[model samples]
Target chain A: MGISAVKYLLVFVVSVLLQVLFCNNILIARVIAPFIYILFIVLLPFDTPRSLLLFLSLALGLTIDVFTNTPGVHASACLIIGFLRPVILNLITSRETLESVAAPRVKTMGFHWFVTYTIFMVVIHHFFLFFIEAFTFEGFLLTLLRIVLSSVLSIALILLSQYLIFRK
Target chain B: MKNLFKLIYRYHVVFLFVLLETLSLSMVVTFNNYQRAAFFDSGNFLSGTLFEKFSSFAQIFEFKQVNIKMAEENAVLRSALQEMLLKSNHGTYHSSDSIYLPRIARDSSQKAVYRFTTARVINNSVNQQHNFITINKGRHDGIKPDMGVISNGQVVGLVTNVSENFSTVISLLNSKWKISAKIKRNDYFGSLSWDGKDYRRVQLNEMPYHVPVQNGDTVVTTGYSSSFPEGIIIGTISDFSIGSGSNFYKIEVMLAADFKNLVIVGLIENKQLNEIKHLESLNKYGN
Candidate 1:
């Protein structure tokens, strides 16, 4: 694997481990549990193959599910965000940038584009995850609270980590 | 075949998305414990009513068998009652005597702790994020909010809303509903809540780490809430673990009631619920 590919692999393993071990336990107000594992999917190279992206996201989600004992909840939500990653990236950046950008990060996409991209993907992922986890709209407000809080925490963590690790 | 192959290759990305989503969703619905329950949650009023009608119709065909079973049970109950009457007439009966009776029958003179009202589930949904069961009996039938609903002998859900002739139940499979449950063996109680992925399993939270919970141990409602009676079977413990730096065990319970095939259910009316709520509300204001 190339250096960047190796780095991506390392990021995947580290993100999944951190999510399973630490982030899963950090429940603020018994609602906001930060799911930083989606960071790996968020950070994949912009031009990653659609099929490969889907498969990798499935593996990542299922792995998290195995650790958390939630079976397919994570996998389902992650697959959705993964499939939409390209679309979200396309919408936020120009064709030239999309072709040239190696991976989505604060430095590469600039702060504005990167923030918007992260917010879209994180919101979609969290919305799907919490709704599927609850499986009903009866507690619309509670589910919304969980989605918003978790997305904020996940986005903050993703952005902070990007700055700390990928900053030039 | 060539044209089909071309079409498949052309929209391969969309096809793959569909395939992966299908796989993931099926795994979620099939493997998780609550989706199956959601299937019969009675949230979808039309389909739920149709299902209830169909099941009840099917039940009519088995009435002969049911009557036989009921007759046999009644015979056994009569013999048991005869023995009790004999003991009492012989002046050998004591209030503390250990004669096994259903919990509802223990208090001879006092009002029943639980009054069961049979209701047919009219609508249900298990595939959704939040599931509710609509039952036929409602305010007209004296059904009220917070009543516990059950099928067969297993805990089902709680009555959350009631209309003049209909009521909605918050299924146990719903993530919003939580019940106080305990291990049948040790009386170690915890909060049982659905994870929304499975219809067959739920999570028991706040179980102390010291409790030696084992797989397959029975979990039952703790009767801490007026919603459900004490000792109603919820499920069996399927798995459990203590997370690092946590003092509680995270337990997975396999629900006992098959939510996929819910038909006739009983709504439990707690006679003392209003009084308890009134007293508790008074205490809340420190009055």
Candidate 2:
């Protein structure tokens, strides 16, 4: 319990700081921004209670929200991303995958599978975020452009960050 | 019963996420009338302090340029002061919405709706009809929507959206934006618009053809706008002509500010913008 608590807390603080200081600042094409902090929610323990992860995700999202001054944009995006993480993870990891020793890193799940999991969640989170930011169909084209550009930039950054932090 | 419990437990994370996202987006969609959540804006206490740190760095790089700009501005102010000093005219020139600022950055506050703020153009898009300029200001810097943005002395566009520490500005060159302005020499005015073909040239329309026009006349704000002061220096008349079939003039004004080389900027905030908007709305409702 102590070990698990320590790890979760560590990821939480580090993820929030990283998102505010670096990932959010790195604008590719001036439209694309990386919400790399979603990975903290993504990497929560498998047996962590559904209620707990859900609660934690809300807390994590809101903290970033306060820092970002976006009202509830990040909180909602993080919550949705955090919630769907397990469903996607379950789908990505197949039968007999339980015995896997390495965690969610590339060593445990090969590069292809890892990319698939990260890309799928990132796209969903980004899609919802860009749509909410627009908040109107009058901005349909602008919103769509933002989603496409931001998604690509986010995917690249997520992959690179993961490689550096969780080296194979 | 056990299977039911298991299913709920298994998908619980998904359920919670959807709920939270719904809550956040609802806040945005409902900002029409009741702005209860406005207090939680990016300009709120903690976030403002964090962004203020970066604003310091941005201010540092701007020191040399800012000094030069102040000197030129001082010269302009002194001349304006000279006119006022001789004639004893102090209150007439200031437009009702124009509030004198000790510093331009202080105008970026909660009361600012049409406020303009500066950011370094790290990247920008001009070819697209919906061009956006990515700037270093974001949620932390009190940047918000519908805020009129400018670079140098010319109108750029508005703050369309914001992130935590940075934001994206919709450039005036974008097809979606049409800014309010008037001729400096005459009251004849029109909407300043972009054609999406060239970033350098934008078109001004709606000027009556009957109005006496010259090639090198000054065009200033009408003082009819809540966003800009009476003489914020938008541009100079470059060319004009009467369309073959229309009653209005088609004119192009050469912008005084070099749009491409814009770095530091001062955002304008109309002090009385909200009250005026409210009054306009009330009249529409009454009608």
Candidate 3:
């Protein structure tokens, strides 16, 4: 348990660093900003306490907010997803499957299940983030376009990391 | 009371979620107001140092482009200097001696109006509706809020927040930031603001339709605000049209500065800003 806790802490730091140094810099098409830092919250062990998950989400989101200069947008989005993670997990996986699997990774949960979970989570995150950043529905279509494009990029990166780093 | 406590305990996660969201959303609202300097920004110590460190590595890839732009700016300055020397020797009357003189000489003749210092952009974003640029200079470097920032002889942004070692600039691409601008051909002025649609294009509002504005006509700063001096090149008129039944023309300007490739920027500190503001306040009270 002690080693596992240290490992999770390492993942948190790595995710935030990767996001601030690498992911934030890649603004494809001038609108899409890939946010893969949510991987820390998304891939947390399913048996993790609900309160612990929410707190961790707040920390992760606030860190990204500081780097990007968007104070509360990422925080609010992360909170919503963190609170809903279990409900979404319950919707997707059976009781026995979740009890056996330690966390939601491509290696443990299989490709299809993990992809669906990531898509749902990333979409919720980016949608809330972009709209809150906009703060208005003035150019509703344009904001929606940005959310879609950014989510596609973020989802792709999150899935790729599962294979490349979390395979073991 | 016991039942209430039990109910709270039963849904404590939901309550915690709501409380946290409220805190975050309030932060968003306060930040949007533009004057409340929130501490949760990249300009703070830890993140600012982190951005500066990583940006140094990333900027290595952009050095070639930065070098080329600097050389071009140097060439322009050199030609302007040559012209000034030629005119001075000819005894020709130059309307503005202060423009060509150094700060020491200018201060001897008249109060220094503006002082400039350059800084490297450690972080910048162009896509967001409320975009900000972070620079390496801050309070220790004499950077303060409300100072104007320019790059490549064009408007880049205005300083909004200053920390110990870094400052955050409100980018021109931000929809909330508006600057006073005028047409070069005619003295007609208007408020220039971004539409959150394009980074390269901004809208110049309140220009009466009767003014003969044409495509390619240069738009420059009005000098009405202390943030910028008179006649800084903002952009050229791209496309314009008047909405039906409206007296003003909707002028679209293509910004001169390519914000995406910004590396170095000049900050303009208005020395007379406080004095002017002080006098204005006194006049209001005196009346």
Candidate 4:
């Protein structure tokens, strides 16, 4: 348990640093910027306590917010995802599968399952985040395009990281 | 009490979700409503220090490009100065000796209007609807809210929040910010705003359709506000059109400063801003 705590702590710090320093600066076509820090929330243990999951997600979002100069937009998006993760997981796979797997990953779960799970979570999170950040429906088609492009890029980065680093 | 305990236990997750979401939404509302005086942002100490450290390391890579631009700009300024000197006193400037010319550029009649402090860009974002820039200077460096920030002689943003060693600038690309600007050719002023679509192109509104704007016409600050001085180059007109049934021209201006490569910026401190504001307030109530 202690080792696990230290490992997760390391993940938290590394993701936050990678996000603010690296990912935030990648403005592809002046619209698509990958947000990979959400992978931390996506990769949390399946059996994480609901309250703990919500708290961790909020803390993670707030940390990104503090760095990016958006106060509550990210926090709100992350909180919604944290709340809905269990429901989404149940819809995707059986309760028994969730109980058997220690955590959701490409190695533990099949590639198809991991891809499906990540797409759903990332799409939902980006939708809420970008819309809230915009705060208005003006030029909404452009905003939707931004959300879609950013989500695809974010999911690609998350998957790439999983393959390169988390393959044990 | 047993039944009540069971109800509370069963609905605990829902209660928690509502509580947390409320907190988050309230924060969003508060932050959006109040762009100035931010506390939980990069301008705060911990993130500010982290970004500053990171930028110090990152700025090394841009040294070559920055040096080239600086040299070119210096050459242009030197020629402009020479022309001004020659025009002011035709025969008196016989020799190009350093001692004959006046040391201070401002004569006694021209009081110093603006003072500039150089600051480094530690953090910046342009893709977002509400883009902000963080600089490694703050209240200690005489930077206050509403001070205009320029880079490479082009308008960049306005300072909105300041800490002891860091400040956040509301980038010109932010949809919420608007600055008064005018065409350099005809001097017809309009309100310039970002449309949250593109960082390079900003919308110049309230320009009457009869103004006869053309592509590549230079736009500059109007000097109507204390934030910016008159004739600071904003951008040149890139595209323009008249919307159906609208009396005004929808102008698209390509910004002069490249926000993507922002490294160093100058913060302009207006010496008479307080006096101007105070007098304006007096006229409000007819006192």
Candidate 5:
């Protein structure tokens, strides 16, 4: 474990703190929820094994749920995305293109493609996450509206963070 | 078995990711439905103490703003106090046993002494049909359900529920609010309820169209019940109109309290509330 190991740990701790404090505090109408914390999973080292990716995603979701008090909504969504990421990445990018890349970045995937990919994954995750969190159809329409609204918000935040911090 | 273990060990990253993702999703679902983890909230004495340490530092920055606002408010209140004293000197008043104004520096002849204990409003919601105020005081602080709550000497609402360290109040302007009140000057009394249109106004019902009511008349609680201690200020008559083909006059009241900037409050314990409630319910249930 060298400087790289320490840097990764620092990044993980800081991301969690920021997610809890800043992102969650901006609950627009108490509906739109930002899961930009998923950016951690989304940026995992390329060639990271599928099962490890799933496990880390699960850990990330559970940590958030523990803090915020919304239980399994995030954990389950992260699993499905983790399992499908390989397929989705393959569908969007060729084997040769991903081979040269270490992680998902605007530079590797190209800006428009990266944004589109993020919007899709974040929206899918939020839809299942919110639907399960609501846990009822009494206000089914309201739940859908919340999902759509939060997805847009979370995607915007993720895109902005990526644009600001990571050129690639 | 040895080969399988080796293969899983070799691909541990994939396994780790899957396990972590599954764990995270479960937390979200359980939290939403069961709220199991909420029991472990920072309310634990240990974490609470830690947060309290942080709050002391935070309060340093907040105190200046609060004190400055209070000082400016004190100046405005002084003028209002003078006006009230002048009005009372005109000798137009009613004597009630419930409202005990102990501090009458101007007139040493003050009657019943109403004591006030201030509490902070930590959370409030005006969007609900039955709006509620979460005050930071609770059973530890002598707050109980059915007690009267007031701000600036006027009725705000009644205490409805109490947690160990928190209590919820049903504000008067809520649509679900219905409190018995009467005209302070006369025997005419009615129920006050809000129609949810304005935060400043409420509707008075059941007053017969012939009560000789007029605009700017003072309205106070009849105190016919134990929820309030008789004659707590409710509001003043703002406007009145006769409903189409109805036997009652639809009346609007401008509440006597400025509800939005509530900082200090008083929770009144009638001391006899439970006994009164027991008697009233006995009549209905015959138990």
Candidate 6:
């Protein structure tokens, strides 16, 4: 494997461990908890192969699912985000930067672009995760609240870690 | 064949995406069916060990909350014991229907009625519409599906799935849960269900409007099914109103057990459940 591939694997391990061990237990206000494991998917090299990306997303989600005891909820959500990542990148980044940019970081991509990208991905991930978990529209408002609150927390944490850990 | 190969290669990413999503969703849909028979859940070896380690470390900070809940449970148990003693002393216990004593005497020909097993709640959730609780006891501990769970003499939920060493309970707060309940004063029975709105309040429907239902009236299970015994405390009527153009009363009840603070519970196994079901099924064909 290449050096960059090894680095991405390390990031995946750290993100999953942080999420299952600490974030899962921290129930803020007895409702919302941040899920930062999506950071591994968001920070993958810009030109990562689509099949590789999809497989990594599945593995990441299943690992978290094994810990949380919700078998497929996370896996399905992660898969959706992985399939749409390329489309979201094309929409957010110009062709000139798309060809040049190696990875998605606050330094590589401008602050505004990174923030928008993280927010969009986090919202979509949380929306699918919460809806699939509930499996019904009975409590629509409550589920919406959970999705919104959790997305905000997740985006904030992802951005903080990107700036602190990925300083370049 | 060359053109077909090129087409397949071009759309392979989309095909893989669809394949993985379908597999994951099927896993979610069939989760309940295979969960009990298989050990792929959090209760299994690898995942269970990881959770156990995390919990042991996290439990230190939760000690204060655990202590408070224990104290509250102790208070509820003490009050219940005092009430039972008072009833026995006043000579009113035998007159009323008592769950502890069976209507039939202990004769050698009669089999056991109900058996109780204690379990600890390792994980619980009340925030979701369909809530489930995971208990540390399971099939190895004489627990099975369709068993009724109670805490401090109040209704908690029903056991729906069980593995070798763990069981999942459908909490009373879940929208799918329903129980046969009646007013303590008049024996007027109604179907109790949750509205998925609040954790503390559940709704009792189909009560005849003429029945003099009042706030604070006690509600208890009717024991109509083998899942739970008769006279188990469910809740108390908190509010009631007659729906317009309807002949039934819409009553709201405050649940007896605080699901959010649940830790220890009792699993009730009806020893006569199979026999009762067998006899009832015999009557289905008008025999």
Off by over 4 Å in 2: A2-7, A67-69, A95-103, A137-145, A163-168, B1-15, B32-36, B57-221, B225-227, B233-287
* DockQ class, candidate 3: medium
- Looking at candidate 2, what is the lDDT of residue B194? 72
Worst 10 residues of 5 chain B by lDDT: B97-106
Ranking by TM-score: 3, 4, 6, 2, 5, 1
User: Which candidate gets the maximum lDDT versus the true structure?
Assistant: 3
Q: Write the per-residue lDDT of candidate 5 for residues A1-168, one digit (tens) a residue.
A: 377456555656656656754565454563455667777766666687677667666667666544443456556777777777787788887898778877788766678888878876887777777656555565677778777887888888777877685443
| Tens-place lDDT digits, model 3, residues A1-168 | 998899899899989998888787687776788989999998899899998899999999888888878888889999989999999999999999989889888877788998899999999988998889889998899899999999999999999987787565
Task: Please provide, for model 2 over A24-65, each residue's C-alpha lDDT reduced to its tens digit, 9 standing for 90 to 100.
Answer: 555545455667788777666566666677778778877776
Which scores higher on TM-score, 4 or 6? 4
List ranges where model 1 is wrong by over 4 Å. Answer: A166-168, B34-287
Q: How large is the C-alpha RMSD of every model relative to the true structure? A: 17.9, 8.4, 3.2, 3.9, 9.4, 4.6
Q: What does candidate 3's lDDT look like per residue over B22-133, in tens digits?
A: 9999988888765545577788899899889988998788888889999998797678667756755433223442335333323344554677788999988876787889
lDDT of 2 by residue, B103-205 (tens): 3212334232333345655444343334555566666776655555665556666566566765556677666567777877777778887755456667888
Compare candidates 1 and 5 on lDDT and give the better one.
Answer: 1
Q: How good is the docking of model 5, by CAPRI class?
A: acceptable
DockQ (C-alpha based) per candidate is 0.14, 0.28, 0.70, 0.77, 0.27, 0.50
* TM-score of candidate 4 versus the correct structure, residues matched by position: 0.92
Error of 2 at B245 (Å): 17
In model 3, the Cα lDDT at residue B229 comes to 81
User: Which residue pairs does candidate 2 place in steric collision?
Assistant: B116-B267, B137-B166, B138-B166, B156-B172, B184-B219, B184-B220
